[model samples]
Target: MAAALAAAAAAAAHHHRLSSSSPAARTRVVHHHHRRRRSSSLSFSAPASSHGCPRGARALRRAAAGDGGGNGSGGVSTGTVDPAAASSPSSSLEELYRSCATWTWRGMRVNYLVRGEGPPLLLVHGFGASVGHWRRNIGVLSESYTVYAIDLLGFGASDKPPGFSYTMETWAELILDFLDEVVRRPTVLVGNSVGSLACVIAAADSSRDLVRGLVLLNCSGGMNNKAIVDDWRIKLLLPLLWLIDFLLKQRRIASALFERVKDRSNLKDILLSVYGNKDAVDDELVEIIRGPADGEGALDAFVSTVTGPPGPSPIALMPAVAARSPVLVLWGDRDPFTPIDGPVGRYFSALPSELPNVTLHMLEGVGHCPHDDRPDLVHAKLLPWLDTLPSTTALTPVSSPAA
Candidate 1:
């Protein structure tokens, strides 16, 4: 009876020890499996550290291995890791915001935005427009090239140095200076409306060798003599109309002038769309439009360009550019400023037919600034053409030239 009692007590004690060991061992295996899954999910290749063991198991193992450093603490302390250091590339793009810089050129502070990365692409906005006009194309173009959109002198964020003559030649020189100093490279010069004229002049000048190609969008340089004569009549009336425009600049007068057309809705929408976001079309932008209306010098810049001497006359320069560089002319068929069927078309048609480097594309249902209205269409046509051009077209060691 004494022996039997002893054996029963031993069996009970062994069963108790087995029950406790099995649960702990099973918990440790589950814990290790969970850690492995987490590591795999994070793509972490780090070796499993001693801490990879279950909370109490690591301490138990350490104690069993005679390592006195590990106390009987049930909790496991893991070192902290930086989350930012493990962040993805998309997070870097989210941190990017549009930035601007001012550089001195011909004693004028010209403001420009340099965004994205790749080959250089210089964008010039037209009259009554700021760099804001290029908002639609900026992101798309930035994908393949570093896009620099600038506010021409006296426009947008640029310092309008009071009394500075805003002639096309002067503007052209300013752009050339900008190209030399800010866009140090042979850049693809893309210009719209009056800006196109400036780009043409710059390209015509032998000094602007950095201009690799020309993309003129709904250009105004090809103005016919009859249009010039008609515009002169309006300029003669500017002195009398000046007072009315000044008083009505902020009021409905500016909007009324544009609203007189049959396509008022489209025109109004286009004007508002240039702001990109409606919030940007605040009192400040309204003031920019009114500045030229109130100032006599600004009025002269507009009048002189249309009726005065410095207006865009492509006859002299177009022939020269046609001989040298690849000139891609894009005209909006429905352009109100420079109609395809009007004097502008006649001027372009008069160009030598056999010119090998010149190409003309007529965009349907687009207006004065196709880059703003139909950027995807413009980009679709542009990218393919650019691909065909020699890879050496981009200037080497790209840097802005001295103004």
Candidate 2:
């Protein structure tokens, strides 16, 4: 894996804008891409595939789930719903919530579902998403490892309390708390987009050994567009960013904008912008993103996230993560938000060359959400890494520390 990643990083570095002039500079660029931003934008809508998809929710039911080291897969999306966009997946998720349990943190409810058997693996979703977003992958992942997927605060069924900061740090702290109170052991954290950032922070947490491994899919450059360099990228986005921020301050404008974003047609268009594979942007997927927006604090969550801090950059956090867990990075080659050849993607693709323990895969033709877009492809790459890890059975359980 190291050799493959080193070669991949070397290849990515050669084609990337931040390619190293010297051998040593190669390692430094992984750290640099996190600091600098270039161009990024939502693309126009692409047509969805008409091919039939197997019922993921149904398949989940067939899989054996529980953490007794059994060979099976399963999980539930333990949370409430806003009732706007209902589907089989949503019904199953709500059932999971009914069957499992929830956590109350600082007066906010966090819903989570766990299944299968092996080392614990927690799944966190990106912005405007929830545990339901992971419907395709969780059951399969549970087969080999115990899987825990949660609706982060302010998203999904989780409470979005008024006056909450909703910053990256806030989310990261939430992950840490979940680890301490729920998992009660060092677990592998798999995150996509902003969820990856929170996991990065959780892995770096020194208060307790919370995370033992990481899987980042299309990890975000920062929490917002402001992460871009002051050059062309920033210049182009500044005006729009300012306009959006200005409008969000007013409830009426914010509601109007939110409505547009929530539109099913616009939702498909938004997915096409970052999803390399148009076929993955199906009715179910759109509904997953849509339902949460109807949840009570969804609008507030969006406003705070857009205006909040970008959070700790990989440059600030990667080194520490590198020092601890072996990292697996899977990037969608077609992701507009962080293209494989783009500056941010360059940093990520070049990661393995600098940090030998980290392995990077640029999933061809995949987009921002590879796990959801092409779960089979993701599983093929992910399973081998899981095979290489030490047995979770040999490890002693770490008790949750006092808060």
Candidate 3:
């Protein structure tokens, strides 16, 4: 049985490479820029597939509070709707709050939000984060793109079914499935931390070319990645991880540990530790990370994901993905979880030098979640790069239904 499983995994990896191979020469560029912006050295070449995509340049007004409503069958609007526009920040929040909807995925309730209208851009949050974590960026991004943010199953308001073994690959599959069943179109996937790695896997292994482009923010290493690292610290850390894994299997112990971890104060401290801009760790952010912990199966999901076998590593998947779609990597230099100086960060820092289809940007003073930690700086870089993408196809606005 073990041998059969290994063979299947090997076959899938080989298929991923074969499916993603393209004859076009890849273009590579790397920029290590800061928030305030300074002149930086650059070397660049155009991607093999660069072409004009018909899209309006005018900024879209945020959908008025009472103007939009979802049908609840994926809550996607088909026809063009010019809902009244509001310019205030409060209205932006109102539009976002009113846009909430839920989708049933594999007998599980998955919470999601869709806003604005244009080509689809899916925003995936990191571990323990949900749709609300993208609160600061989604409204602004939705102006130019139809933004879709989902609470991955087991996180946020999504159903967290107990005893369901969680793996990075499982989340990746969920992402691809969401693209197929919910979005129903190719999309540019923007993900942070482990979410970024999931997007990488989805883009690499997708059978239908569902992913158009990838924007990764400080992508993380797999949970079991320590097994492959040659460093002495990893050698020591592996045993500790294994010990924790064993302890977490005890329901009582897992529940107790989870309780401490999810405490409001503890969550805030954890957030502050990783956020480069400490001020970004506000009460709302803390609540966003804390709200779902009370769910019935949250503890099981947390334990399972923490102890699960490492799925495909981004380093192994990026080559296949870059061959088929352009990749934009944004790393937060101040991140502690996947420290910029760590093996994973170093690998991404150097990836663009080898793969022409990959572009790397190191965001100085930014922590793990660059999108939330410093949305302004993130937008400054992200918006321009998005305009230059070769794969843009317009889709009708999918107005979010009233909450």
lDDT of 1 at 126: 80
lDDT of 3 by residue, 1-403 (tens): 1111122223333333333433322222222211211121111121111122234653332122122221111111111311111111222433444566776655567777776777889999877788888877876777667788888988987778766777777778778777766676689999988789889988987877689899998888874444236545556656655566676665555555566666677667777778877767777788877788787777766766776777788888888898998888777788766776778887887887788777776767778888787665566556766776765543344322222
The per-candidate count of clashes, in order, stands at: 4, 4, 5
**TM-score of candidate 1 relative to the true fold:** 0.59
lDDT of 2: 0.63
Q: Which stretches of candidate 2 lie over 4 Å from their true place?
A: 1-100, 393-403
Error of 2 at 9 (Å): 36
Q: Could you say which candidate leads in lDDT? A: 3
| Cα RMSD (angstroms) for every candidate in the order listed | 33.0, 15.3, 17.8
Q: Rate the local accuracy (lDDT) of all candidates.
A: 0.51, 0.63, 0.66
Q: Residue 228 deviation, candidate 2, in Å?
A: 2.7
lDDT of 1 at 197: 79
Mark the regions of model 3 whose C-alpha exceeds 4 Å error after superposition.
1-97, 223-228, 394-403
Q: Report the C-alpha displacement of residue 48, candidate 1, in angstroms.
A: 44
Clashing pairs in 3: 26-356, 27-356, 28-356, 69-401, 70-401
lDDT of 1 by residue, 1-403 (tens): 1111112222333333332322211111111111111010011122211111111223333322232221121111111222222111111111122356666654446667676665677899887566666755665566556777777766665655432445666677766666665666677789987788788887887454678788888777432122233454435644534343342232232223222211334334445543222333333334434443343233223322333244557766788887777877766666655666655555664443556676666655556667655554465456655544554454454443333
Sliding window of 10 residues with minimal summed lDDT for model 3: 70-79
